[model samples]
Target: MVCVPIALIVVVVLIDVLAPPHIHLGPLLVAAPAITASFAGPRLTGLVAALAVAAQALIAVLRDRDELFSANHQAQIAALVLVGASLVVFCVVRERHARELSQVRYVSETAQRVVLRPLPHRIGPLRVASLYLAAEAEAQIGGDLYAVARTGHGTRLIVGDVRGKGMTAVGDAALLLGAFRGAAHRQADLVELVTYLDGSVCWDLAEPGETDRSGETFITATVLDIPDDDDRVDMIDCGHPPPILVRGGRARVINAYQAAPPLGLGDLARPRYHVDSFGFEAGDLLLLYTDGITEARDSAGAFYPLAERIDGWTEDDPAAFLHRLRRDLLDHVGGHMGDDAAMIAIGRAPASRP
Candidate 1:
């Protein structure tokens, strides 16, 4: 690190000596600090800028020629002015970086509050637990999404896999959720709710290159509606992975027939959407996840065993179960996921007297 700073100062001094005096070296002071913050952070950037300005001032003092300015006093003033301007530029760049970071953090926090509500250590007569991970840090939030809404019709929930990743995927995800939340609050039928989400996603992708699935890029989703009255639940699967249901001390993966070819891939002439039904017994658990979990790989090129892990996760409290699963996943891949990973587990309250 010390060698790097010394090397940088050497280069700057060489440029200052070789370049014409009027070459306008403002970029060094104006851009360097802001760029540095991303790599070395704010404090180191400040130190670097201060050191650079001091070096420039020293150069000016050592090589002063009194021909153009015609007076030693005027030359000294010029040197001080240039140094002050450089300092001001560095300070302004630092301030701009701080403001930009503050805004990003604010938006990230707000997105979490609105789009990804914290799982209630418990949810509506059930113990709810979840885990979410984003592969790319640039997107703290990714394309995969899920939400649980208690409504007039039932406690409606849905988990979806958007066609792409990154910002475009996030945009599509926001559209789908906005529709789901709106329809769940108003529409009583599970069929209409899924239809609403499907139509909304298709309409939003009406623009060019939106529906173009680059490589089977389509939104796969499963919508579930568990009525408050009983343990029965109805689901709509659109090519997404079947959620695993653990019950009676045994774990079984719940797979419904392919009702549709996922959202955003449907044509006007295609067959209609079909809703599938299932029953959630008391004391049973359901786990929903995107492809990321099943696709995670170890360096030796082995797929992560999500199903095996879920089997082992049985009988533990929701939190501890999720914790164990998360640790095993990290150990499998050496602490990183290549894509976004999302898991939601909802368990019915323990057995009640008839």
Candidate 2:
């Protein structure tokens, strides 16, 4: 990049000296700073500007005695100086903005790490893999959240989507995750754990100005329990998208017989959360995802066919299966997601000791 401006200086100087005197090429030096803007920073831009001005002075002095101080030469030198100074200012401003953006990205990354800790590769007997894709690249993590914990009853998990976007929703996700973690071990029952989470969310929502929305903001969540010795899984769906069960290279949604109202909306309607049972034998995988995957759309406005795409991916390994699904989903949406997407893949070990 430094070589680019230096080469431009050399070429422009040679052309100015070798061309016919009737045509002045000294004005071409302005390009040095403009070109430097693309690849180099303010310090290099200033150096290029200095070199250009020096080259202009050398040309003026070496060409002819009268041309050195003539009004035309003075005007050319003034224009060059003005433009070079302006480019230096441009570089300075650009550098400041670059530093500011870097700082903002640093803060965002730290927040994401603290709020959405990475999922472990193995939790109890199930191999686990999780992925999070934020709609805005700058906002590294959003309202979508997932959590896994071992308890007296089984390995408990929750995948949820909050009501809104931005920092407020992220705060809500953190709160819910904290509540689930605290309650999962002590409650010992799926309904009791979910009831604790519901109380926590209702308490948070009842606080005025804690959330941005005025009325009826809620969280849609799915809670799952996989006993270490059992071949079945239990789920409590709170108005969230159903988990998909993959077995024998086939994928099918496991919709609950009756879904309870979303958390924080239980008071509006009498809440009756039911535990839906499903076969989750060895060599089977359960895929839980937020609406972002199903709601993702292509250029033609067609929603992403997540179930159809996963049908062809027979990889039972949680990591590989999720990696393929993420790639295919991005390809379907042309690499732009409109909302935060999160997925958790839990594959039951094929062989377990009795």
Displacement of residue 314 (Cα, Å) in model 2 is: 1.7
Stretches of model 2 off by over 4 angstroms after superposition: 62-65, 69-72, 134-136, 208-216, 295-303, 330-339, 351-354
In the range 174-211, model 2's lDDT, one tens digit per residue, is 99999988888888688988888988888887787664
Candidate 2: global Cα-lDDT? Answer: 0.85
Best by TM-score: 2
TM-scores vs. true structure, each candidate: 0.66, 0.86
**Number of backbone clashes in candidate 1:** 0
Model 1: residues >4 Å from true position, as ranges?
1-113, 136-141, 207-217, 351-354
Cα lDDT listed for each candidate: 0.69, 0.85
Question: What is candidate 1's CA lDDT for residue 223?
Answer: 89
Q: Best-fitting candidate, measured by lDDT?
A: 2
Candidate 1 lDDT by residue in tens digits, 276-348 = 7787877777788898888999999999977776674556466666777778888898898887878887877
